[model samples]
Target: MRRIPLFVLGVAAVAAAAVLIAPGDDEYPANVVLPSATGLIPGSKVLVNGFDAGQVDEVSIKDGRAQVTMRLTNDFAPLHAGASARIVWKAVLGERQLDVRDGPETNPVIPAGGTLDGKASDPVEMDKVLAALDPATRTHLSSLVQGLDHTVVGNETDLRQTLRQAGPAMEALGGVLRAVGSDGPAIRELVGQLNSMVTTLVNRDQQVRAIVSGLSGATEAVVQQRDQLRAALAKLPGTLGTADRMLADVPGTVDKAVPLLEDLRPATDRLPAVARTLRPVLADLRPTVAQLRPTLGALGTLLQFTPGLLDSAHGALPGTESAVTSLTPALSFLRPYTPEVVGWLSNWGSSAANYDSNGHYMRVNIPAGISSFDNNPGVMPPGMVSDPFPAPGAIAGQPWTDAFGSGVR
Candidate 1:
């Protein structure tokens, strides 16, 4: 103010130059070819992953396609190859925007002015949707709306109550859904098993039908005897009481049998070995048992007459005893002469055995003094010098019968 400083003026000049030369923002241009550009226009917002990062600079029709130019800030610029775009509703008021998506980082970045083929997903207009419906469909939709309006218009209170109650119902349904989801695999397996069971039942339909028919016949038979069945049923309580009383003792009996079973444990343990041993023995005995059949038959035949034989023997026993008693003395008397009788018989056989062309003849030696004709006197035959028959002790100096004592012999 007093006198403008040159240094301040120079400083202001540098600040002005810096503001004019400094870069504002880095923007990349991109083109999108869309099938339609219904709500898209210049100044429409562009979004990348739901974040505003650019705006549509222009929209024009070219070769039957809507060619849109986008100006994107550097933060979202130079989208990689394979980038895509789609026009979507920004709000319920028919406002539209372009939704962009970046491709994989591994792809090269798209250069400025590169084109992307936008997905033809124009915002849906309710009027167009209604207009596209066929007459029949529209009629059905009108009928449904009328039915709903009739159901709900006058019953607003009840509908509100139902809606309020529906909260718990929906919560319960959600819990059920969660539970079902948790056991999905198990439920699926159960369903598969049920399917298999159904298949099996189908396969065995004839047998199952036969069984059902038999059961039906049995049921009819039972029904025919309903009177008797009723009588039995009338007695059933008493019978059941008796059975209950009887069965009450069963536990006691079982308790008593436990020790017996325990006592028999050792024998039971050895039973397998016993059975193994008996197997071969029983096999070997089978032939022997077969052989004994005839003998047993003969014995059976013999036994049939055994009582008569026993009776006859019983009657003859007394007489046989008496005869044996009668023979006892004679047998005793002959017992002492047994050796002499045996010797005489042997000597007589030898003497009578002589044979010479004729029949057998006895050889005898006649003593000189033993002529049978003269019994009056002691006679000597011719050529006899001495007595051929000596006195009892003359020839042997011993008595002739000294061996025979004064005893019973």
Candidate 2:
């Protein structure tokens, strides 16, 4: 009876040891906080990189967040510091799972029962996507679907033909994709350059907007002048034809000019010498040219009044012409007497030239006539009358005489 009791006690100890060392003990517990626990529940499957590696042991809401406790198997236990988890759809029937991803190897491994620093991503639900759309968008989406349905309804044969033709096109597109994939580094560089360009454009967005506005205005102007442009275009063909005809004569013109060009060769050869000779002359003219600047400015100022001066001259021209016409006849009539006037002026100057100390005086002589009071009858000459007061017939019959015997009849 004592041996049986000892054996039973040993067996109990071994069973306890086995239970302590079981595979379940290798599992590590961890906690992850999520924004919501909508699809998660206790006993939900946990996947690590798409492989089942653990299970959600409990899910509780605390501080407005879903605190999920997970028991991971040994293979995925002690996840690194950067490890993350997300609740994802597992099936079409609203089934959900926790998807855990391993962190980079550079990160420190997380201890068992520790909370993961990374938060769980919220589950993406189709119903939520549908609910997010506004009424107009939903209506448009429905219309698009109906349109597609209508388009496909009666186009089976055409669709088949299109599909058949698309095979080669798809193959070509695949080849192009493969080519692009092979040149990924170059494509990446191009993409980087494009990104840099886009960034520069974004930095100068105001200038870009101004340019776009200017282009829009220019486009509008062009549109407004489209009729004029069209007319110009209509005339262009004839213009081009005329130009072509003109150009056709060019070779003959060139041929004809060849001899002239050859004839000018000697002169052309001398041009360098002429240029060299003129170099110093041009240099000498520089100061003169500089001096002329003020003069030229004055000339320009004077030139500004030229039009007004010309107008004034034009206004005076008619009066001058009329005066010249009036004076012409008088001048012509006096022309023949010019010599007599000149002689008289000369004689008068000579006559007035005689002078003495008492100044110039003219001598006068009076001879006795028939009417003189001192006249005697015995001294009377032939045909003379002695009466002081003679009859008119007697006065008429006698001729008057001066002391010089010059008779005045």
lDDT tens readout by residue for model 2, 45-95: 998766679899999887878899999888776688788888887665567
Positional deviation of residue 74's Cα in model 1 after best superposition, in angstroms: 6.8
User: After superposition on all CA atoms, what RMSD does each candidate show versus the true structure?
Assistant: 16.3, 22.4
User: Native-vs-model 2 lDDT?
Assistant: 0.80
Worst 10 residues of 2 by lDDT: 400-409
Which pairs clash (backbone N, Cα, C closer than 3 Å) in model 2?
none
Error of 1 at 87 (Å): 3.0
Displacement of the residue 230 alpha carbon in candidate 2, Å: 1.2
- lDDT to native, each model: 0.83, 0.80
